[model samples]
Target: MEAKVILIIVTTGLIWLIQLSSVEATQWHSKQLLPYFRRIKLDKTKNSVYQHTVKDAIRMHLRIPLMQKALCLPKGTKVSKHLQYADVSFALIILKSHCFHCVLQLSSDCLNRMVDKARQHENKFYARFTYACKTHAEYSSDCMESGRPMYYRNLRNLVKQTEKCWKL
Candidate 1:
């Protein structure tokens, strides 16, 4: 009788533990996953302005490398030398090969050009937004007097957009 009683108690304890774990897991999913998926959906719909800005910035950015190549500086020459001279060359080689597999990787020339273009785009976007904010703040009264609140609304939107861009 005592053996049967202990067996029942053990089974009940195990069931209770399993139920508690499942409840915790559900709570975690609701707290973490819901916001992540919602943000992704929001990001997709609202990215048009950023997309156009990035595209223009990238286009202008790509020209610099073409100009450099035209000027006769061979690509990868400086980077290869720098990598070879660095003390972490072996570790870097292993990491590069492991992560990128080398086969589908961009050539050093192309990678550098793309990185530069991205940097330029980021700078340009920041500058454009900053200038807009400054200009609007200086002439806010003009905007208010123009018989349309469009400029103030635009300025508010610009501030919000700038915040989003900076987060990027």
Candidate 2:
């Protein structure tokens, strides 16, 4: 009876090892048949191009020189048409910026370009803007009084909360 129990234990161990090896072999064979090229082709040929197209559609009418300069880095030529378009974009941004925090947080250079464009117009909408960290404790007194522009801490959920507030 002792010998029989030992044999059963040994058999079970061998069966587990064999199953593990089979799984490894199947993975190797499947990987060999597919190759990495198939996965890369899908990302570059599909998703990347799709993202580029969407970006193109959104920037259609904006004639931004700084944006054109950034885009033309590899192209080695100057684009002239965007200068006029940038001005138009600036006016629209200032009008909408009265209530959008994302617009306020854009880089200094982008804001400069937008302001330059805005200078050409009468700034009728009065773009009230402010900054915030993630914590809600840093509210600006002006923002609270007007119930307009507000600040926040740089917390991860800030964008979500901002979107929620703006939606209302």
Candidate 3:
């Protein structure tokens, strides 16, 4: 009887610990973004909608989990070197989900140019990671202002858990 009681207590304790850890994991994104949040330059001269839209977009991109490891990289780790092992398709996923959402709206020439740029800057891993988010924010704000459904579509497709993207 005593042994069974002890077993139940241990099980309960383990369950509580697991739950606490899960909660911490969810908060990790917010914690990591604190620095960026503090550094945001809110232009008082701009309209409230414009300020909010850009800020929101920046927040959303900075919080992406897959890119977190790359964004807040380890001390002394070179992002370009780190990215050699990273699945390059993550960039594609972002570009496809955001910049290429409305394929019909983009001219073949424009699409080719963007694709060429992404490919051309393959070695610029950290820049690509950080720039993609900042760039997305700017583009996102435009779509939001223009009332393009592309912004909503991009939100829905933002994070697809592919083997390539999820693989660490």
Candidate 4:
């Protein structure tokens, strides 16, 4: 009889402990960003919409940040590699791939020329030449691929995403 009573008390205590744990779990909510990209820019400028746009682009792509052993990385990362020696990153590419969604506030034609010039200076920098319909038709079949941007059918959708994301 005593053994039975002890068992019952232990079971009751276990159940109560489980309930307490669940209650504690509910209070432990936290923000979730994948791969944990910590922003590295040291700039303190708060008035630039361009900076906000870049942040919005990162959010849209949902890119996993550079975790440990994230990606060995190629010598050339992207067109922006020419502009900046630092690798542009997969997160940045997936985020910034859209012409209309470009956070840099640069036109397709202008940016393309800038990329090409940069390539002239350093072959290591020229990574990719994205096909924008408004430009790059003369040298690329991709411009004629589907009456859309070379990467995705997403010209309109990209523009829409950019427009909607502008407020963020």
Candidates' TM-scores? 0.23, 0.23, 0.35, 0.21
Count of steric clashes across candidates, in order: 0, 11, 0, 0
**What's the lDDT for residue 125 in model 2?**
11
> Ten consecutive residues with minimal summed lDDT in candidate 2?
120-129
Best prediction by lDDT = 3
Query: Can you give the lDDT of residue 149 in candidate 2?
Result: 20
Each candidate: RMSD: 21.6, 24.1, 16.8, 18.1
Q: Please, what are the lDDT tens digits per residue for candidate 2 over residues 4-97? A: 9999999989876665454333233223322211221212332343334323322332222223222222122344432343333343323232
- In candidate 4 the C-alpha lDDT for residue 14 amounts to 86
Backbone clashes in model 3: 0
| Runs of candidate 4 exceeding 4 Å displacement | 1-16, 19-47, 59-168
- Provide the lDDT at 30 for model 2: 25
Pairs of colliding residues, candidate 1: none
Better lDDT candidate (2, 3): 3
- CA deviation > 4 Å runs, candidate 1: 37-168
Query: What local lDDT score does residue 99 receive in model 3, on the 0 to 100 scale?
Result: 32
Error (Å) of candidate 3 at residue 73 is 23
Q: Which residue runs does candidate 2 get wrong by more than 4 Å? A: 34-168
- Which rank order by lDDT, best down to worst? 3, 1, 2, 4
lDDT, residue 104, candidate 4: 21
**Residue 101 in model 1: shift from native, Å?**
37
